[model samples]
Target: MTISIAETAETIDTPVLPTTETAKPANVKEVLAFLVSQYPLCFAQDEHIKPLKVGIFQDIAQRLGDDSQISKTQLRQALRVYTSSWRYLDATKEGVSRVDIDGQPAEVIDAQQAEHAAKLLAESKQKAAEKRKARMQEQRAKQPVKAPVAPSDKKRPNKTLVKGSKPVKAAPKAVVPAAKETIATVAPALLTLEPAMLAVGNKVLVKLGQTPMPATIQEVSLPDVTVQLGSGMVIKTRQDSLYQA
Candidate 1:
């Protein structure tokens, strides 16, 4: 009978493996990249499955310092193993049903569009400044000259106008067109003046006489309401001043 090496190895059964306490870090960047690349990719839908809410993806990328340099596929492989042990890195769908940024869903705004809008606003302001400067210079050029003073007026305390010489024309006052009155047929909303009313609940549409103006109710005072006509402006109005639709 042969003393088999297999029988000896079987007799010396290995002791049970020790329990693991430490866990590996999940490469969140890789996980996000994989999710983004998935088909029918809706930010709201994909975010629901990520361990970290899609909200935290940017923060993680910033911490990583250069997620763009790393290959997404490689990251997915690493995260697959890393998240296997770490549970928080596990994906779920609790927060992915909607697509609104303020809402629960993960929605991304267009940075390029925002940048373009800012550039346009800056250019518009510069043009307006140029127009204002041109108008001021034009007015300065039109001022009238004073006529020669009479010898008799020199003796008097006040500089009296000469009778024979043509009187110096007074500079004409610049007339500004009056602001069109914002009269409306619709009545303003009767919002309760409280802390809750301060919140941007909703914008009220107005039919000011025959003119329709878009304004959001900003501040609610006792008898007056403030309307925001966009462009970071407010128009204070009395309770009986206008109507809302």
Candidate 2:
């Protein structure tokens, strides 16, 4: 049975070597050469060394500190300077074997692991989009639907009596006649006084229609006279409208 390099790396853990007080890797190039010799399956070399995993630099720093004189911090600082000169490693764009770093093509030694990581990221994004769509549907379900309004009935004028369909005539008003004038019959004693003698404040008998009433002269003129009747009713008429009393 033949074991693949990917399967072998997963099955066996990297053993922690004892620290040996000797000349440790002095630069990033020497440090990278040591890492490649220890874990040949975890790295690839083209124009430069490229890590197969995302945190390969950190893992190398920790492992190198265990058996080397260099501190993990010093190793990390050197790794930073080295990686900065290379292009950004994007797992999304570079799935599985081939990737471009610093405009140079490199290989992924752990191709299966890189492909698995890319698939997980794609599935996560798909699930998030589905959850967003479901939430939008739930919000729409909670909204109220408006009922349509009905139009009002407008009142129209009573259809113009249907054009001479026996036009209903209005009731006639009652007619009132004008009061008539009459000659008043005076007593023989009062008949002796002449109309010229009648002055304002003089008592006289006046005829209003057919009724003879006694009144006081309020004003006197040649033809018209104003008088106040016994009932306090005032009237203005010709001097002939009066009789001596």
Candidate 3:
């Protein structure tokens, strides 16, 4: 029996279409494993590593696009967390959080170098302490020691003569005038010599309270004079308070 072209076409069966399985998103551990496998040189056991080139996240995203359902943004965030973990591990192992690799910044564990640096720091501190102690001792040696002051003796009161007691008459002796008395009698001559004797750097008597103490003339300005006492004390007073010694 002869069949039309349309009827013959209807008798043919339709071809079956193939189904595609959805991609699964990669977890952080899987991503880390991929990274380690892809760049074996950048990873070490119990050590940290960093990507040398920039845009590493973009490269990884593109490489994992077919197998992973994770977006580039998600992958980048995961890498950040992973990098932080590496830094923390590095700090604990090496005593430093970062290092340099192939002239690029990275993190690593280098126990030997860290220990050496610690040793050097301790030695420097010890040497500084020793120098400071020696300097303090030298300063103490240069300082002058002060002597303790002694207490002054007080004068005892004279005994009063009893009433109705006859006072003893003392024998009178002839008075002889000394050379000093004769010189003192000439006031005009003494006045001219006194001014010449009172000058800076000369020893003078400074009246303090009822007593006159020895002092050196530091300054001889008009109306006032500065003197240094024997106790190393300096004072300023009126010129009249000073006398030639």
> Best by TM-score, which number?
2
Candidate 1 off by > 4 Å: 1-107, 146-245
Measured with C-alpha atoms, the lDDT of residue 1 in candidate 1 is 21
Q: Write the per-residue lDDT of candidate 1 for residues 1-245, one digit (tens) a residue.
A: 22222122111121121123222223443343333433122321222432333334343345445534444444444334322221222233233232322234443334553354345445545665687799899998898768998667445534568889877777798999999997766844543334343434456543445454667877777466787765656787654543433
Q: Against the unseen true structure, what C-alpha lDDT does each candidate score? A: 0.43, 0.56, 0.54
Q: Write the per-residue lDDT of candidate 3 for residues 1-245, one digit (tens) a residue.
A: 22222121112111111123343334444444444544455432233443333455665666666656656655665455444342322333453444222234455536875565455445545665687799899999999988988876987645556799887555687697765643333332111216665688998888898567788989878678889999999999877777766
lDDT of 3 at 81: 44
Q: Regarding TM-score, does 1 or 2 come out ahead?
A: 2
For candidate 3, what is the lDDT?
Answer: 0.54
Instruction: Give per-model TM-scores.
Output: 0.18, 0.25, 0.25
lDDT of 2 by residue, 1-245 (tens): 22222222212223223334366755454554454456555543333334344555565666655766666755565444333322213232334443232223455546565565456545545665687799899999999988988876987654568865987676687787877776567744435337666798988888787666899999987688899999999999777778877
Sorted on lDDT, best first, the list reads 2, 3, 1
lDDT of 3 at 29: 45
lDDT of 2: 0.56
RMSD of 1: 34.7
Q: Judged by lDDT, which candidate is best?
A: 2
Residue 68 C-alpha lDDT in model 1: 45
Weakest ten-residue segment in model 2 by summed lDDT: 3-12
